[model samples]
Target: MDKQTILDVLNNLEVVDQQGGDEAWMLVDVTPEMIEELDHVGVEKETVLKYGDDESVCILALAFGEKYANFWHKGQLVNWPQEAVDLIEEMESALRS
Candidate 1:
């Protein structure tokens, strides 16, 4: 999938919950199907799994207001996974540019 196509999928994501302290920030439960789509778009399973627990994980996107995206395991961010950071940096640089 192309970048726009990937974004189209994100655009269609249903809001699962609001993030704490930021009323405009919301969580989207990234389903297995969604992960497949992301994988098709070049986000590897390893990258996705970096944020996952034994059960599942979230692909944290800004529900509304500001447009942002991040991955989180539980409510805290994990730094041990280099692939996750690389991906995040790529996306962040894209946004910055």
Candidate 2:
């Protein structure tokens, strides 16, 4: 995926939930389709796939104001592709405006 494609995905992200209270966090599930797109852009496929066999394997939780992006897999924090992370952070920043 090129930069625009990645950005598009981020823009159209399917928000799963928003934590309540002072620190409202945005959550988006990381689907297999996302992985496929990222794979085209050099994201590691095998690593994400090995975690599960479903359409989605992880959740991308972002604290937009805090500039934090975390990948949650099976309730644990997991390292995601840096390119994807950078794209997500950019998207979050844009959303804040």
Residues 16-74, candidate 2: write the lDDT tens digits: 66464455444555676777765665545674444333454332322121122244333
lDDT of 1 by residue, 1-97 (tens): 3444555555565656655644334455657886787678666667655555434544443211112333443443333356876887798799999
Candidate 2: residue 20 Cα off by (Å): 7.7
Clashing pairs in 2: none
TM-score of 2: 0.35
Worst 10 residues of 1 by lDDT: 61-70
Which residue pairs in model 1 clash with each other? none
Clashes of 2: 0
